[model samples]
Target chain A: MNISIKRKDQGDHRFLVAVSGEIDVFTAPELQKGLLPLTEIRGGTLILDLNETRYMDSTALGVIVAALKSASRHQCSFSVTGMTPRIQRLFEITGLMELLKRVQTSRGVAND
Target chain B: METQEDESQLSEYRTLLAHYISQKDQKLPTEESEHLRRQLHACGILPEDLLGLHIEALKGAGIFSESAMMRSLNFLMKMMSGYSKAYREHQELKDWQKQLDTELDIASALQKTLLDGKVPACSFADIGAISEPAKRMSGDYYRIVNDGKRLVVTIADIVGKGIPAAMCMSMIKYAMDSLPENSQGAPSYILSLLNRVVERNVDTNMFITMFYGVYDPETGIFSNSSAGHEPGFYYSAREDRFMDLEARGLSLGLAREAEYKEYARRIYSGDMIFLLTDGVTEIRKDHDFIEREQIVALIRRWMHLPAAEIVKQVMRALKKMQDFSLQDDFTFIAIKF
Candidate 1:
């Protein structure tokens, strides 16, 4: 599957990464490469938007967890928004829902 | 220097130079050119100076007039650009290959440890199983649990292959081991418990097809349930016929309230139960899948042998038909009563 990543600077040490398509074995590496660097920025807020993601595997979940860990070590805030029900179910099943911060986006409001 | 003879010689030299340059093939230099340039630099001779001297020689020979010099310079520039682009692409490919190799090594190590679990021993039935992964990791898993009075057999195939499926299989093994002691003998109940665990622990995008069976030697009864797994075949020595042990259930991790129905059958001495993942039956010969009846026939032919030998012979036969390398993970279990 293909994974397209778009990075948006939200000003004041915050970044938004909108990821689309499937995050599977073939595509997780691309996603990891894009998100891991953002987590290293100190005291930054990294938001991952997965509203258009069609699917995610355990490896993808592992990558997300790694990003969260890196963010925590750098004293940065990390959250994921616009999770489809399928992706949300994956997070729940793998017990990663507790580790990852989930944000709700109402209409066109920015994910804070 | 002011001789007409010298001028005529220079003109002749220019004609000769142009003829040679036009006749020789022009090809872009490869990475070896970089090594040559480095060697030149180490020898106190700059590569740019070397090129400048050659250009001057060509100009003095009258082979490189203003337009000709520009054409040669442009060709050199394009050659350098092409070489650098090729070098970068080569390095990127090497890096990607190295990364994939490391990942496969880690995945293979993890899969080896999980697949090497001890097989349970039974007095009345002899069991043997083998799993061969198509890649560095496998999606197929099998476990045997003997609680002295009864034997529980489970064989499952996850949706995908490689590291992700291996991770899921490892989780399934742990979940199966953690089932309640009271739920050991009920095939349907054990599958239900396993389904719940998978639903809670595995990704929804992935699912597992499993066959869970519990055999009681004391009562000569075998109860089995499937979660979208292939139907195994049972050879009845008394009736001299083979029957499929069919059960209805959805694949695990499909839903929270998935239900599995169990089927029970009496076992007789000299009977054989054969179970396998799709890898065995799905073997492609020419363009069509190997017939299920062929698998059943093979089992029947080897029914008299020990379980281990039977499985070995069947695998040998499958390899003969499929050229010794399957496209997916191949797992098979044979139990002789």
Candidate 2:
């Protein structure tokens, strides 16, 4: 249940978040707190690094999906990196990998 | 034993009680009662200390003078005795529970073997399935109905255990049995009917994640739907790739007004439809769990075998991967068309 989240502002509204530790129901709220606001980075990229994250449940997946949706609405680009095989497979199983793959990879698009 | 501070507080309480009795005709303010509660707490009187006070009053011995008899022994002794009795009853209940669990396990096995009959035969597709419980009972349930031209397979990952979960599965099976035969075509329609049964009967905490797929051998189309279950896989032997069986819906019994969407895929010759529960993919490796891709890789590795043989081979490898000790119920069904 020990999750560590660190956020760095890359200037001009761009952000990089590095998350490590277990992400279950207990720690998902903490992750949501760290990821949601940065999704509003207009015309910027929000890169989420989950390489050191050990475990995650469906709840954490939901949080990430919500963050992706928020980013899309704000015209911010979103992408995930540093997923271990175990974590990557979780995304695949829940059908979120398909969604993640479709997430707008370009730098900016105007929100309608 | 009473602390020195508690002994002093007791004298103070006694003096106050004597004063109250002497002025019995006068009404004390409500604040005085609150003050007494605080004073008792300040004197380290535990919640169970009242038992000692009550015992003292019943004896009318006024043995506070002896002081030695006025400590927490009364509370501890009574609590210990009560706890001892409760522990004995708990052990007895566990024994009865063990007995009930065994009987239920037998009943469930018999239900699978004797009652529902065998998995119906499909002329064009070879079907293979295996459901193994981590405990004496399995909460995971699967039902396959094949009527030559059409095959409807439903797999559910129930969120409960033992008698309640088994009984729920039985009820669901009965409901499915009673539905009209034509209802088999629309996976969404069948799921809605099952959803009503689950919403009304199953406990609020117990929800079910299920995938219902109806395959037509004549048309080679497999129409499917999901109820918050894991996305299944469709393997194309010619393409050498797996397409995500992505259908989204709320978990059964989550809400009475839930809606499920349907998806259709063309099943070509040598293509396989794979549906499974979390138990299989969540199988552990030391501290971490195996992912769904590993299962996909396993299927691809043994792609040349018949559907049934591939199932057995994948299970054998998975069993060894986890060293024969499963942490949850492992249930999966594969059909090669």
Candidate 3:
């Protein structure tokens, strides 16, 4: 029902978003505001931290998926990390984990 | 109660009920009993509606002893109060999962009969399906019926839960069974007929979402229809990607004259149709839940396996995601052509 989102710039247009609290249907809209703009950071990296996120629903997941898709279209680097086991299960069930893994693998290859 | 026909039927029922009430060793003849039931239904009467009044008449006549009637009344009152309390708790707490009584138990049994339906063997299409309830009673219902020439699969979720929801499901099952299944572009027709039934008889607060599809082997075309159900996926083997199987309509019972449109695709080799209830995608653990994309991935990963095996693996993955504890009824069908 409650969510807190803090955005920090890592310079060079790189941003790290730390999200915490419960993100069910009621609060997914708020998450959308904090995450979508950063997704279009063109030539920069967007990292979302869900370590403090205690809960999330399908609506919130949709927001994240939208951000993921938007980032891909913009050709910006996007990454997600710090998922609790519970949150991890959510991603795993949604096939987002596989998508994220593919991105990470591609990013790793590009970096090398 | 006012019509001459009703009066005549009432007199007959009065004679039958009175005799039955007085004599413990007598049985109503089957034809007569069926006629009485049909007449009662036609008169918008339930048997219980007549029983109390009949009992009062018999008591006044001193034909029935007071003790047995008092005991029956007391028992009925007790069950009524129990049901009232259970319903109250259910509403206040947002917990619609409680199985109210023997009626709900019977409804749950009927739901299992739907699950036990066999997928008709099709040389061109292989089908796999299963439905699991989160509790003793399930709001989700799926049935796979072979119409001799084509296979028809129906997946539905009642908006409300418990006995009433299950009863609606039974009505749907029978109604689907009686439909002319072999007609081309009949998926929409089937949903419209079902929608009329739900709108007329079901409670105002209750509605149902259904996805129905008929697969034709000769043309390899699977035409589908939806009644406010989530759109499923159609995997195109040639394209090597999944596409949404799109069709639109209001949920059944929302509007008496609701219309569902048909969507069709030629299911080529390696193509499959995937249909499911929201329970599979909305599964929430402590901090997270699964979604449609995750399910699509599960299917894509298992595409090479047998259709039945693909459905089973998806079920297993969903169970694991929810930590082997379901929060809702899970039912899905995978059809490969």
Candidate 4:
């Protein structure tokens, strides 16, 4: 589990949480702990960066959904960027891709 | 008389062998053939019969007479040489086969030891972890340990497949064993320590993606660190949503003093936690890679079930999609908080 939580100093208060690796039953909790705290933070756009991610199972997909809900309660926006082809297909198949803004990289995001 | 009969059989067997040799363009020695002819002429049978007997023993030698043949030293020498060669070859083959089998046994045992089963602590109620190696030895390894305060569980995958990967897995196990027990604070620190241990020993070409965590039973809080392994999942029944817990960390052994961040979260009583290796993600269906939804559907379908049932259901889905034998090792560990 690799997670970096960055709060913007003076911008849109964007929270970029870059994650890579397989997210499944054993590892889901790690991401949950890392991201759940971000959800509690007052207001910031939560960006999940997953470019280096190689594989994701249902347990992992569930964590992202849970993180989204956690952030939503705080009125903080949540989205996934750097969707690998495998993960992108997963997001699309799970119907979450439509719900989140999928970007190739954090820099690739056209919207601030 | 018996010596005469033996000589006749010997000559006959020799003739057959000579014939076979001739067919294959090998010429018979004149003295040898002449001796065989003499043995047959002494008896009523043709020289061919004598030669055939010789071939049966496959040890044709000089002819034996009535008196001297009884003590036929020449015949004994021929028989000894022929029998010795054949027996030696057979013994050699058996020995070689035994040696090969021993090597395979050691490899198999190593594999089994690497994937040792966890007696799933009775406290968890339902917990299961399994790994299916595609070959003789699997590159996948998983462990569940009670950290007194929490259950520290992990599953790791070495990048390359087969024995090499399996060896790397062994290194991971040993490194994990060496880590300090139940240390509080960040799970990432433990992983960082393990990463240094793994890096110091493993080759630069090999890297491992691992999910290592300590889960507190009382707090339902789980802290974990990933090193280029896989994503994990958290299922929330109240919200009817499955969240993807994504953690980004540098792969272990990639660099010296590589820094890995730790992630922590609390799980409710109804929530479930799932972790797996890339083998699950790389599962194939109809000559195509299985998309994440098919996997989620498996979890969604089994959400109401127990932890073991959920793990089994997902495993079945992967098995069905595989159609053929899975090319990579498949490992899944599930724990319901």
In order of TM-score, best first, we have 1, 2, 4, 3
True contacts kept of 2: 0.04
Off by over 4 Å in 1: A1-112, B1-81, B181-185
| Candidate 4 structure quality by residue, lDDT tens digits, B1-337 | 9887686565555554445343433334547655554555545554345345544654443434443343333443332333455568979999999998888779879778766766457475357777787677777888887755668788787765667777878888877776665656466887788778876887534567777877777877777887766787777756777877677675565545656677888777777778887788777676577666667778788767777777877887788778748767888877776
Q: Between prediction 2 and prediction 3, which has the larger DockQ?
A: 2
Candidate 3: stretches off by over 4 Å: A1-112, B1-107, B180-185
Q: DockQ of candidate 1?
A: 0.03
Question: Taking the candidates in order, what DockQ does each have?
Answer: 0.03, 0.07, 0.02, 0.02
CAPRI rating of model 3: incorrect
lDDT of 1 by residue, A4-102 (tens): 999999999899999998786679879889999998887678999998886665456657766865776676778888987656744553335644532
Q: What is the per-residue lDDT of model 2 for residues A11-46, given as tens digits with 9 covering 90 to 100? A: 877789999998865687799899988887677788
Q: RMSD in angstroms, candidate 2?
A: 10.8
Candidate that would win on DockQ:
2
Candidate 3 structure quality by residue, lDDT tens digits, B151-203: 87888886544555567777777776676546544889888889898778775
10 residues in a row with least lDDT, candidate 3 chain B: B74-83
Displacement of residue B65 (Cα, Å) in model 3 is: 60
What lDDT score goes with residue A80 in model 3? 87
Encode model 3's per-residue lDDT on A40-73: one tens digit a residue.
8776689999889877654466577667766765
Candidate 2 interface CA RMSD, Å: 7.2
> Model 1, B88-186: lDDT tens per residue?
898999999999999889878877887774567788889988888878789899988788888888899886667778889999988876777746547
Compose the digit string of candidate 2's lDDT tens values, residues B269-319: 888888888778778777667777888899888868877788788888888
Number of the top lDDT candidate = 1
